[model samples]
Target: MSNSMKVSFCCKDCKRKMFDYYAGILNLYIKCNRCKRVLTLKKIDEKYVAERMINGKLFV
Candidate 1:
């Protein structure tokens, strides 16, 4: 059997729940369906951090 975990995060601009991902994913780049903004997810220090991409730059 394989082990997996659920990872959920919210959009920085909209404050809405974006999606639920599996723990196996360490990094991801996605667009917020509600606000239509680009977002990136990264794992740091055993935690998940969400950042927004704006004007070709990343904002935390």
Candidate 2:
């Protein structure tokens, strides 16, 4: 079986890198260490991953 979690947008803004988990596996919110931009992930059947940005652009 598989599982998923609805994470809060603000929760990811932690001071340090924290681990995000789903279905007994570990995943992370790919935020920039310098800019602290919370990288968003598009769920594609667990095998593929990508960043969610507006018009191929990202903000600080």
TM-score of 1: 0.48
Per-prediction TM-score: 0.48, 0.25
Clashing pairs in 1: none
lDDT per residue, candidate 2, 1-60, as tens digits?
235443222223443433333333233456656556666545432222114323322232
RMSD of 2: 10.6
lDDT tens string, model 1, 1-60? Answer: 023434456676887777754434457688987889997657532233223333322333
Compared with the true structure, the alpha-carbon lDDT of candidate 1 equals 0.53
Highest-scoring model, lDDT: 1
Residue 10 error for model 2, in Å? 22
lDDT of each: 0.53, 0.37
Q: Note each model's CA RMSD in angstroms.
A: 8.8, 10.6
